[model samples]
Target: MSKAAVETISGESLSRIVGAVVGLAGFATAVLAGMTTTNPGSVTLGRALICLVAGVLVGRLLGWGGEIAVKEYLERYRKDHPEPEPPAALVRLKQKRDRHEQIVEEMKKSA
Candidate 1:
């Protein structure tokens, strides 16, 4: 697909976006649990909000990164596999051009 179409694949999936955000939140919360000086079994609203915002930023980054990686991989695969030939009309046109070139060469030879 073209660049614009590929962009749609990255940002258009609600499920993927939500999944990334939730996954980031879980990971960040775990890290916070270990790194924070706060007491166990308690979280302040401000801290919680900070985590939420951080998760969202990281999640968006993760989601976009994943999509770009997949797209690049698929593009590499496509380069290996190669696309189908051009359409039938184009094939016919090329054949006609070749025949015309042959006829022109014959005329030049006779001349």
Candidate 2:
């Protein structure tokens, strides 16, 4: 194994990058809101944390929306350009196997 090779993102990871980005945006908004709402003498730490969490949640949802949209589009595109059907001989073999399975199941139940 070469330890020096550069790693590249796969198509799936590339797709989910949208989600990660959205999460970051959410986190930022949360932190900002938290920072703004605390009193002058109070510890803003709690507020900051609460907002940070909220931000992350928001970002995740946004990212998910994007990912889902992409996935749907890809699925639609693939459906329109499907792979070729399997050979008739292969289909026949599958049908025979299914029939054999049902017979085995019926015999087991009777026994």
Candidate 3:
């Protein structure tokens, strides 16, 4: 499979797994909290809110963790197999073209 395809699949699978884990953990916490509380209604509402917040926070953490993992993996790969340096002239020309395009885009947007 292509690199792009592999990356996309890995990202989606990671997200799903993270989501499931967060959801399960949240549910378990809520249930435990509910069991320990005296007021059923208040406890249930509070537990639900806690679960929602926990799931969001956990998901965000997982996303950052995945990004870090990918960065580390790429760094290791680069270390193992170094790439040849591109011509300096060609790199400068590409940068100039990019800058020109950006200016043109800004002009068009302001028009």
Candidate number with greatest lDDT: 3
- Cα misplacement distance, residue 6 of candidate 1 (Å): 5.5
Candidate 3, 24-111: lDDT as tens digits: 6787778777777775877786777779678867875785578567767887898888988899999999999999999999999999
Model 3: residues with Cα > 4 Å off, grouped in runs: 1-13, 78-111
TM-score of each: 0.45, 0.45, 0.45
lDDT of candidate 1 over 1-111, digit per residue (tens):
566323444656543575456656755675576456665434544555566666776677766677777778888999999988899999999999999999999999999
Model 2 CA deviation exceeding 4 Å by range:
1-42, 57-61
* Per-prediction backbone clash count: 0, 5, 0
Better of 2 and 3 by TM-score: 3
Q: What shift in Å separates residue 47 of candidate 1 from its native position after superposition? A: 1.1
Which pairs clash in the backbone of model 1?
none
After TM-score superposition, the amount by which residue 44's alpha carbon in candidate 2 deviates from its true location, in angstroms, is 3.8
Model 1 alpha-carbon drift over 4 Å, by segment: 5-11, 14-43, 83-111
lDDT of every model, 2 decimals: 0.68, 0.62, 0.72
**Candidate 3, poorest ten consecutive residues by summed lDDT:** 1-10
If both were scored by lDDT, which would come out higher, candidate 2 or candidate 3? Answer: 3
Give the C-alpha lDDT of model 1: 0.68
